[model samples]
Target: MRKVFLFIVLVAISMASYSQKRYENNYVSVVVPNGWVVQNKGDNGLGTELMSFYNDEYDANIYNFGMIIGFNQFQKPEFLLETQMNLKSSNPLFEKATFGKMYNSSFMGKSVKATDFKTQIFDETFKGTAYAFNEGGCTVLAVGSYKVGTKSDLPQIWRTVKWKNIRKDTHVYDSFREEIEAYCAATNKTLKQTPIVSNGERYVSVYLEPDANIITNTYKFVDMEKSSFDENKIEQIKQNLRPILLNILKATAKNAEIAAREMKEGYIFKYTYIDKNDEFLFSVKLTPDDYQ
Candidate 1:
């Protein structure tokens, strides 16, 4: 019996080590189990990132578990508490989630507030814990989902999220601004003169009508890449345009159906607006160059 117990303990330790994987950047480091894919770095937009680890092991169901980290010049002690209250009230999932009382906690020796929360989707209840901690002049968040009825090690994963002792180059925006001007001149579009500076990064807003047919809503993103000449950069612009597309679909065309297809370097967001009788009103191919 003593030998069997010792073997079981060794197996547990081995499995834990095998399941852990680490993701680190200049700002933060997090540990996630294998099978959690990291999103494209460019998709993070500026100093804030919403990275998720998605697992679709269950048929037709997906679980998103991850952290959001924001870098700022300075953060107050109340930052975490304010963020917790805001999330409890404003998060899109707040209405659907069943939350417990918020209580004080500490992570990596930094003061924090934590809450137990759960949400149901497709008849499966995803149990999770949310934490808000401010450390190293930044606001760090940890959110995770666990398989119900099991001993959860998610807090251990969160505890592994440590801040790095490095900072970003604040001049990236200035260099990107020059590129924006050049791209605008080449494409014959008016790039907004003023830029938004948040979290020590600059973002430029631009609007495109695509031949006087689509709506004139402006799209915005962090001015990271120098030019839209690259196919990959252009594709990233298309991803940024998705939210604008959905918001303007109704105003741009009646009963519109938006679809996207991948091209060599970029993508084509095809918008098909239909009439009351299901007849097509118009179709627009929203490409990356449109916003250049």
Candidate 2:
């Protein structure tokens, strides 16, 4: 019994060490909270790839400290500012008057343009910071926001951020092109929206059709890694995320059904939606890393 107890303790320690390590990519790296979920790590609709990270312990419906990073090719400071402003424009509570002056700053040892912005959504006003800079022929932008009455934890995240010069030829979205193209074909839509990978606490959403909302947006996520998929992990994903299908379709009167298929790498989870007239509207597939 004592030997078994020691072995269990060792296993716990090993998992903890793995969970506490920093996540690194070709362009940037950040130390997130141990066991925090990473959502999208690839292409997003902004014509660039995005990496978003958030903790899962917080309720998904509540506002929590999160970070988003985007990479573009050598956009001018003015252009980057305009792009950032456009993002703020989408939020009804973003007060243009509260936008602070653009200023010079440094991030990860590189010169950057910085701005402070305020957004009032619902019953709360959020204070946020944004940074844009050119690094290794690519432009990197980082944005973080926190609700009022809550101290922003983004500063430490920013301080811990490390960047690497990315090559111009690196294809961030190439691996998933075939899957994305097929998804577009099925939806009867042209491949226009750039997909992005974002990390979340419990899932990663790869936007196959970001512009399409309410009725047409198509995306997918799975709970297994490319290296391998485990039965236990698959069951965990099904148990935790099976409700996602209904939650997404809750606002619509359309009927939806989930289909599962087993593959060599892992299982595929597809959500098919049909309109009131029993006509197919759209379908999105959540496959393992094989489709990523």
- Top-TM-score structure, candidate number: 2
Q: Model 2 has how many clashing residue pairs?
A: 15
Give the per-residue lDDT digits (tens) of candidate 2, residues 65-142. Answer: 344454544465545765457544322224342678889987667778888888664456777777787766667777
Q: Write the per-residue lDDT of candidate 1 for residues 151-229, one digit (tens) a residue.
A: 5555665677776764544454464334333333422321232222333232233322344323222223233333423
CA shift of 147, model 2, Å: 1.9
In terms of lDDT, model 2 sits at: 0.48
| Model 2 ranges off by over 4 Å | 1-18, 44-47, 60-64, 87-98, 170-292
Looking at candidate 1, the ten consecutive residues that score lowest on lDDT are 255-264
For each candidate, what TM-score against the reference?
0.43, 0.47
Largest lDDT belongs to which candidate? Answer: 2
